[model samples]
Target: MKKKVGLYFGTFNPIHSGHLIIANYMVEFSELTEVWMVVTPHNPFKKKSSLLDNHHRLEMVYKACEDYPNLKPSDIEFGLPQPNYTVNTLIQLEEKYPELEFALIMGEDNLKSFHKWKNYKVILERYSIFVYPRISKGLIENEFLTHAKITRVPAPIIEMSSTFIRKAVKEGKNIKPMLPEKVWKYLDEMNFYK
Candidate 1:
């Protein structure tokens, strides 16, 4: 049987415990053999200035996921282009690694606004999507639902977000428990978001 891999893409400005919890849940709940945290250099919809440097963000992710053997940090989009689009990245990954089956893992909040993505229809047709609940309202719906192989996983209700973390750091507050110890140390050492 082919190895089932989940491509969990995110900015991961500074990976937190919430992301890890969802990732662990996805692995246990789904057929995924492994989950790759594809660190996106830029998200077309989000503002650039709000995010930390790509390398810095990637480093933080590496530290956060260091203990998980199944979790990996992929820099595939680092050299691709600015304002990375999911469709384009998927195309490249598929062409390069045909032996592995890839699934798109995202939170429900992203699903609510997924239609705005470029060539989103093509994406749904090409790969399966594993949706985890976010702080968003309502269920997943729309034209793409019928075409895509979709699975909804109920993640732990930890409303921790990177935005909230950044705010706390800016205010000189401690972020214990909200983030991994190693990640927090790295962030503190590097003085990120300060």
Candidate 2:
């Protein structure tokens, strides 16, 4: 059988326990054979100034995922053009790893706004999406709720946010418990977000 890979895209400004938990859960409990923590170099919707250097963020993801055999860090988006779109990345990944069946791992919150994404319909037609629960207020598009390509996974709802983590670090708060031990050490040594 072809290996099934779930693409978990994120900036991973500093990968935390919440991110690790979801990726680990998806790989172990879902149909995915592996979960790739795709470190996004730039998110078109977010400001570049607020993001850390891409390599630093990738390193953090690497450190955070090292202990999990089924979890791997991916830099595939780093070489892609600036302001990359999900559809484009998916196409590239499919071309490069034709032997693997790739799927998207997203939050319920993202699913609510999935329709607004560039070429979202095309994405839905080509690949499956694995949605994890999130405490979101808005309504998911009724169509997405019943879409054949979308699968809702019963993963724990982790409310932790990278934005909150960055704020805590800037304030010199003890955020060790919020991050993986290795990630915490890397963030501390580098004095990021302070």
Candidate 3:
């Protein structure tokens, strides 16, 4: 049997506990052997100016994922093309890791704009999609995906975000609970998000 890897693509400006919880939960609940956090340099839907340096984000993800052995933080987007699209990244990953099966891992909010994604149909056809529920986001109720192979992961919804952590740090608020020990150490030592 092939190892199934869930590709959790994001611009993890700073990976948080919520991200860790979701990725970890997906492993035990879904058809995933491991969850690979694909750090995107830039996403088309998000603002470029708000994004931190790709290296910094990748490093932070690496630090955050240190404890979870099944959680692999990937810098795959760094070597690939810019304005990283999910389809392209998945294709490249499949090419490189032919031994493993890849599935797109995302939140329900992302699934809300699934139709807006470039070549979304191709992505659905080629790879399976595992969507985790968001605290504030609604369920997946798309008409286009009437017959799509989408798996709803019953992962616990922790209402947290990198943006919230950054804002808290900027204001000199306590953000220790929101981050992993190693990640908090890296940020505290480097004086990041200040």
lDDT of 1 by residue, 1-194 (tens): 76888988888878999988888777877889889899998887778788888888888888877898888888889878777688878888888888988889987788888877798778777788988877877655566466437777776766888999998999999887788899998888988888
Per-candidate alpha-carbon RMSD to the true structure: 1.7, 0.7, 1.6
In model 2, pairs of residues that clash are none
Q: How high is the CA lDDT of each candidate model?
A: 0.83, 0.94, 0.86
lDDT tens string, model 2, 1-194? 88999999999987899999999999988999999999999898888898999899999999998899899999999889988999999999999999999999999999999999999999999899999999989999999989999999999999999999999999989999999999999999988999
Candidates, ranked, TM-score:
2, 3, 1
Which lDDT tens digits does candidate 3 get at residues 4-103?
A: 9998988887899999999999998888999999998888878888677988888999989887899999988888777778788888888899999999
Candidate 3 clashing pairs, residues 3+ apart or interchain: none
**TM-score versus the correct structure, for each prediction:** 0.93, 0.98, 0.94
Model 1 CA lDDT for position 4: 82
Reference-based lDDT, residue 128, model 3: 86
Show the lowest summed lDDT stretch of 10 residues, model 2. 42-51
Off by over 4 Å in 1: 144-148
